[model samples]
Target: MPGKRRMAQSARAARCLGVRSRPGALALVACLMGVPEARAFDLFGLFGREEAPPAPRPDALPYAVRLQGVEDDDLLSALQDASTLYRLRGEPPPDGEGLLRRAEADATRLVDALWGYGYYSGTVAFRIEDVVLGGDAAARAAVRAAEATRNRRLVAVRISVEQGPLYRLRRIAVRDASGRPLDLPARLTRVGDDEPARSATVLAREARIIDQLRAQGHPFAKVVRREPVVDHADRAMDVAFTVDPGPKAALGAVAVRGTSSLDPAVVRSFIYAEPGDPYSPEAIAGIRRSVTRVEALGGVRVREGEALDPDGRLPVFVDITERAPNLLGVSARYSTVDGPGVRGYWANRNLFGGGESLRIDADLSYLGLGQDYYARRRKLAGIETNGLGGRLAATFVKPALFGTRNDLLAGAFIGREVQQSYLSDAAGGTVALRHRFSDTFSVQAGIEGQVGYARDVLGRVDYRLIGLPVSVSYDSTDNPLDPTRGIRLTASATPYPSFLGSDPGLFVAKAQGSTYYALDEDANTILAARLGFGSISGAGLAEIPASLRFFAGGGGSIRGYAYRTVGPIGPFQLPIGGRSLLEGSVEARIKITDTIGIVPFLDAGTAFASSLPDFDEPIRYAAGLGLRYYTGFGPIRVDLAVPLNPDKALKQPPVALYISIGQAF
Candidate 1:
């Protein structure tokens, strides 16, 4: 009878306060689980017109939770971080019984979570009850009263914690295989308990300590023990590790497997470890990357064998899976100037089964079926004969020819090309030696010869060309398709001999460099820039054929100008090319999401008649914005740009649009 009277009074109080009318908010307020009684409140959820979900029919508590006695921010935060129930705090469609179940789980994990914060004697007192009542029997009576009316069923969940004491620092010891103390870094051997202890973090550092031992010539180093001792009464913890720094080892011999088509020497040549060299996992990993770089190799595994040999050296095992020696590939792209292009290649990754590679490729561009060409004064008809171009080339590569990461390349090519203001037929052969100093650096030297005929603005001309080209390059970019960091540089010099060509034996050199930096933590926003330059010495503009000289405008160059139309022009208003060139580009690449991005860019460049770029000619500038649809294959690029300096001679609109793949640079 007393409980019944109390329930009636509770109902009357709820009605007087209008708590029973508001449903969601009032139910939440009644339960101390949402909008704590002593805290400020937000009115947003309260003003919404959406009706609160009806409380469940069964006798259940409203969903609300409270924590008590956790005052230390670190302990409180860590406890919350290690909780599954707290993470569900904002989970929608609150259910009283669900939170009750979760609170029970949080209670069970109290000790494990507190151990990290050095609370060895931590205790959790958990409870769930009808939001209005102070005792269990009263809570049951209230639930029965609510069940009769089918009104809100709010439950209050509380987890009161008593954190005994903060543990202090204890010795962390490292012992050698013989159970004797070894001198390791002091930081690795001792840690203070001022912060919470997480097993994963503490254990991962142990691995790094062992790796350091192995890096210092202990090839067989292994962690033998990890013991964390906790003292509850004294409020302290101590940890120890036993390491076996086995004998100093050397590479003994290699056991090769998975070789059928390729010669075993092909793989051996790439292994950096010599028979007596110190065994380093890092060196072996470099070898692995090098060997796997070959087109036909996959699934490479390199490791030290089971046991050290009697000679105090470790045997090496190399297992490499070989892909088919031959492969076929095709690719295509589209741009306003060339319209659309398609290319195909047949490659022999292991031609002679000794890591020799070869490829035969052909491409047809300038389909001229899409956009209209505004070349010179002529509005050329669509897909005309003069717009078509094709080329065929073959390349042979002999890897490890000079040393590991070095290759000898021999290639020959024949092609017919129709560019703005010119038609040319050409054939060439090249012999080159390339060496990779590291993953991000390489150097190449080559000699190439060509005989070609061209119909230029200066009329038909036939010539033989030969030159020596040398280049050094560096790339530290994180991704080829979407670079967010690092820099890429390629510098080359080609000096034509007096006897090779009729252009007064000019020497040409050019360097191009680009940089990328991420502007956001997610690396979805980036700032990129590029600088390029080319110059020719010992030759005049008239002596150099239009085909060999530089021009600064196109889809890959200055976007607002016509193809090959940014340099000197002859009487016929056709591009005559130039002896020197300078180009600059900058872009802000901003990502809207994982698969969509926008880039606002500016490009400025000039080609000068002078042998050296001197800014003597007008520098054409363009500003543009692009939309990018990022895909696994690559970024599909669409751009709109307009010339900063408008000219009628450009023979095109103030605006030009381009569609292609990859970045403009």
Candidate 2:
């Protein structure tokens, strides 16, 4: 009867206050198993039902939760059971405002907790009901009723699944900036926590994987997670991604343009690319490097493009701008046989915009030397005979005449030579053409003639004879300092075929061979060897020039005798520039550091003629040491040599000193 009366009172109180309760919020206020009543008051599940709320415990109790201003017992019970406010079994009153505030705060906390679990739109609320005191000590009874509400139990609370399934990639499709398709790897990444695929949410991760593929050579790759079923009733997702692979392009050809000054042949030889070559950024860069190697040129631009023909082949292009030079320079050289030599020139490269290198030049030299003899009976010293001569040459050269690597250098000049011992004076000129076979090979061939006049030491007069000179050489060494790495072999021969009037077509046959070898890892050591043989037969021995003949034993030859002081086909004469001279040097060179080095050498040579001066005589030998310091242009060398035979010397055992640049060979 008491419970029935409490229920009736609760119904009357709910009607009077017009209070409504929500099942979810009431369930939250209600207390479930293992939850304390004092704390359950803050959770709506503490309330048993919508119509009946719990009551607070006694106000005098410790840690008691009380919904204040409640007079009806049944209504209090209803409200308390549905509220989140709860208190200990024995606690003082927790006021109504404080209880409501706690409830609100707990509701907000519940919403936040849901969000923390990926429930982005999750919510919470509190349900309320009015109550009235129903028995003796009705306020206490109402408080107890509220406590009962806070102690209500919750059964079967709903939990929504907020996370979905994972996605795994099936394939990738790629394309380039030109909209060309690109090949991609067949394997794709699986996404989202490594679980089974259940939803299309894996699409985002698939896109990421595709982007990575594109970055690694598959520029146009893409991924699309295709989920065939809408509901995923089978709990399994099969994804398909389409891939389109286009053709791979190779380099088909190379083209050069805008090269007005440089020879196309030269440019072609320097290029690294060839037809049907693979496209390489490095090779394209090499073309630019080739342009820079040209001596007199300007800016170079390189690009890759499709050929003009519809064949759709890619080719490399090089465009060049050529610079211009207007002035020229000249140089001269001299020796005892060629004295007071002088040469001058005028040049204009890039002339008339037709890209022509025109050079006009000339050269001249005079040579004279004599030894003085004394006659005691005459009581006077007189100048005897040695030799004297002069030579003059002129040339006109038009390099790149047809805008190519070939050159035609043609001109004519006159010359004269005087030798008192030979009693001869001669002059000649030449016209020639030189064509560069490649960047490294060039061939020059020409014809010349000379006439000679002479006064001999024996008072024998001879008429001048003319001859032709022809020669050919092959050179391919890149480093001038170490020609041994590459070799230059030359051969020349001339046989007298005419007399003084008609300018002899040939005479004086000669043939020479020179070779070099690079020895060290850095090409710092070199071994050079040469063999030469020639003959001149046109007049009496005294009327023919012997100075133009061969001689051995000099700073550069045998290294033990003064220059040109070695021979004259006799027992008293040192090995004269014989008809045959065989010379060879073996040198050990080392670059001690970047700037300096030492070379120890053994030089041996012999000059001989079949007619006299026993051709089988022992060869003269010299051992020497040299020091070299590298410079901006070349190396400076100083050498000191000592002949193995000491008594052969007039003063200091035949020691020779020399200073020069470049290799002896």
Candidate 3:
């Protein structure tokens, strides 16, 4: 009987706690009964008390906000923005007390906002339902009366602002920590006299002073005090800043922390700072960037010691967090002209623990789609139409090689490329050393070797090749995947030695640049432009390998024409590639929503028969519209393009569709 009574009590308690199952109720009940404090719980509270149905929550009150006396539109808007009562009018407070409390807080906020806008003597007053809120008691009574009104009509809430004459800066002064005046350059303290006495400007001047001192080797410089004296009669403000420039110090010993499974020596190699060098905030920033370039590092923070060391240098510590070393990813793309392609890659970012990266990639493409149609149209022979093509590549990079700002790069690849004009099977490898001059500039020089067999309109040929490639690049873009501003330039040259290849080797050179400009501060609208030029010399078009020739017109190039179909026409109306190339594009990227965008673009370019672009040759033009679905990593791009001037002889398609990732550039 006792057990049965306990079970019943448990059921009742479970119902109060919103538990549905009997087993759950029993378990909870047993636990509660076993505890001494559980005896204090009112088990019979729900049943013993005569409780009426709870009243429904009242709906939000309807109210209208009115502003008066402040004629300046900017000031009026600021006052409204600072008022909590105006912002949250629809969300009615619990009662009259809540309403009064909100109004009092809004008064303080409005006054502070006025001060920020150079109106130091501004006044704010609030009125509700024809009753001015003067004192606490009077304001409370008025709010209560309004709530008790029977009529459901909208309540009136009014705010009046009186902005006095604007306060102008009379003088500005900078002093040391001991209150002694320090003569600083006028250009360094840019907040001039007679300017509006805005609080933000005063604070900014103080920060600039400290930054200037730090840049001059004062690593511990900071603002010790800031004083602003306002004179009501003169309608003027005088501001003074007291800064403390601690001991001038140099960079002390650098240390690394938070390393697990990562070689600390490898991390130290990325730091460009040396002991006894002048302590510099810029140098600290560079150190963080260098460490972050390591794919194995998840996060990096550089901390300076609070006090200078005995050697009169600041000790620097780099804290790094390591991420998982291995990664696997896959990507796919499709185009009406190029058909479909998929690629997969495996990467080990921290291979062998020395900030070395190794990646292996495999790709497959051209799964028969549109192959037969193009083959029939071009009247090509001995080409592998509708056959699958693929490539396997491996790349390795060792950062901070030889304890310098240089990296060792190596790669090898074997692939079969099937295109409208050529079918080739090639295997190649490259070794390179890249030196970084700064965050935005780099140079690379490499030696490459290749062996391949190709079949085209020129017939089958076997070739062995060796070349030296050199390149220089500069990038100042804020984001690589979706840049909103800045410019990127790249130039490269490769010379194939005649003795190393079966045929007479040639020299190739190319240069390309793109720039981005944002129309708005948030970068929702962007204007981007790109230009490219390429040339090949020292060999006739017939003698050069087909895969090595300059060919334009594809999703990555002209967009409207099919891949390898935009150059000089050879036998059977197939493009034979070219010796020179020229292309340019411009687009306006406009974001319609956070995750959706539209771009209208124009492209103009062509391949030339001669070694340099011949101005006499007519340029091909294409126009298209693109849709972008923005994601965390980048934007997914879908483009629909059409050739503006289709050559009737070539019989090119009127339109082309491309689906891929990232911008066209």
Model 2 regions lying over 4 Å from their true place: 1-392, 400-406, 411-425, 439-443, 454-468, 499-506, 535-543, 553-556, 569-577, 611-614, 644-653
Residues 1-665, model 2: lDDT tens digits? 25554345324222211211222222223322224444434444434433332333434222233344434343344344433343222222344333334444444334322222222233343332233323345435444444554423311111122222222222223444455553544444333443433122234334555555534423334432222211123333333443332223455566668775555655554554566654445456656765555544567788766332245445567777776666677776654322456777776665544434556656554434432111121122121333333444455555554555555565554544432223235555566666655444566666655555443223323343344455666765655554546666666665555553542232465555666677766776666665555555543344444444556666667665445434444322222245545666767666787779787878776655532335556666778988878787777887888877432422223567777887555
Clashes of each: 7, 84, 0
Write down the worst ten-residue block by lDDT for model 2. 372-381
Error of 2 at 449 (Å): 1.1
The lDDT for every candidate, in the order shown, is: 0.70, 0.47, 0.77
Task: Please state the error at residue 655 of candidate 2 in Å.
Answer: 2.9
TM-score of each: 0.67, 0.48, 0.75
Q: Which stretches of candidate 1 lie over 4 Å from their true place?
A: 1-110, 113-196, 204-256, 272-282, 304-316, 367-370, 376-385, 402-406, 435-443, 473-488, 500-504, 515-529, 559-563, 586-602, 622-665
For candidate 1, the clash count comes to 7
lDDT at position 256, candidate 1: 72
* Tens digits of per-residue lDDT for model 3, 1-665: 25554345324332322211212222222233332223222343332223332232445344556778887765665555556675566466665567667778777667656766677678888887877989877787767765764245556678888988888877778889778977667876555556887655565566678788887889988766666666666777677777788898999999999999987877877776789888878777777877777788999999998988888899999999999999999988865556789999999999988788999999999846454445663344656555578999999999877567788999999999887777889999999999878677899999999999877887777777888999999998877778899999999999988876635587889999999999998999999999999999998887777898888898888988877677777777778888999999999999999999999999989888899989787789999999999999999999999999865678678888887879888
